[model samples]
Target: DGQKVTVIATDYTCIGEPVEINVIVSDLPNAFTPGSDGFNDIFGAGAELTIFNRWGQVIYEGTEGWDGKYKGKKVSPGTYYYILSVFDANNTKTTMKGSVTVVSDEK
Candidate 1:
């Protein structure tokens, strides 16, 4: 003789939810030298760089790249402050502020 069997099934669904985003700033270099020997010739203002003077005047702004020059001229040797802001690929925004020193061999 042979036997028979029966089966039952169920259905279900999942829902998605929104989440809050946070921003962070990292990988800040301690120091840099802007010599003209072709190595380390340019000064970096950090990621999403935005440099400003003591008076809060904007000196430079760019995307993690700087040639150590402003207005087609080399900047003097000294310390400068910079503010960095960025939005990651996930559309999250972050801001950071820090200081940097610019040195020259002629000094």
Candidate 2:
């Protein structure tokens, strides 16, 4: 039997591309405690967070995040509304709207 031997070489390159992730907030909490419990203590930073009262009044606004406080006082326990606008480098803006309750104690 006559046979011929052949060798094949393969080359590959891992071309990587920068990937942009989705909004960091996947599970938006409906409530949080501002105390130092190490839990949902602060709002998402870099987000234009505007919290409104039940009457649609801006109760709190901060870019560093809200600690569930208004005017250095812990807001009362009640249903509050919020709007979060996140701006990226490309000027792409994402918005999230929901309600959050401020609780004095963990429940």
Candidate 3:
């Protein structure tokens, strides 16, 4: 934990900022509401997420993040697969794979 570091450099011609690289899996809910209730919302930015159905069909392709909707319609509750590729300020990429369950408890 906390094993990441940021480095900054500068020169007489220009000033440089620290490089930010964080592609770790966030502790997010297995399911979330796409209604924008100001809670568990979109995934982390600076990443490309290719979410797939159980049949291995691509359902959503998000370059920044996902809002639990595919083609402007809320998806149904089910188990889904995802392949997340995160990019840092330095253009370095990190990939991750996991599954999430979508559920709703509303009328």
Candidate 4:
């Protein structure tokens, strides 16, 4: 999640223009494993997440969480992109984009 802040400048003469700023307040993981061992088995955030493949194809879209599967099959281990749409308390939507690697099970 993130927040929007407005800063105004005043120097005893008059108020200056307000500068709007978008502040990021969440840290997402760079990798995860859906090996069904109950440890990092799902990837999720406090917002609507849309996952995409390297070719810009959507693999998953929802808030429930991704189990590293597409169409009932496990995805190949690699880096995938994501777009997170977070709405702040002020109803301002912020989009955060990044990549998360899917680690294959060693066993």
Model 2 agreement with the true structure over 1-25: per-residue lDDT tens digits:
1123344444476545545443344
Candidate 2 residue runs with Cα over 4 Å from true position = 1-25
Rank order by TM-score, top first?
4, 2, 3, 1
Q: Per-residue alpha-carbon lDDT of model 1 for 1-107, expressed as tens digits? A: 01222333334664444444443436555455665777666555445788776677778889856666678777777777877776665666677778877777564
State the number of backbone clashes in model 3: 0
Task: Extract clashing residue pairs from model 4.
Answer: none
Error of 1 at 40 (Å): 2.9
Window of ten residues with lowest summed lDDT in model 2 = 1-10
Please identify model 4 stretches exceeding 4 Å from their true place: 1-24
- Ordered by lDDT, highest first, the candidates read 4, 2, 3, 1
Which is better, 1 or 3, measured by TM-score?
3
Compare the candidates by lDDT and give the number of the best one: 4
Query: Model 3, range 1-107, lDDT digits (tens) per residue?
Result: 11356778899999899885554555645665555577656653446788888999898886776777778887787788888776565667777888877665356
Model 3 alpha-carbon drift over 4 Å, by segment: 1-29, 105-107
Root mean square deviation (Cα) for candidate 2: 13.5
Residue by residue across 1-107, what tens digits does model 4's lDDT show? Answer: 45778998889988799988777776777899988788988886457999999999999999887889999999999999999887766688878899999999767
Residue 89 Cα positional deviation in candidate 4, in Å, after optimal superposition: 1.4
Taking all chains together, the TM-score of candidate 1 against the true structure is 0.60
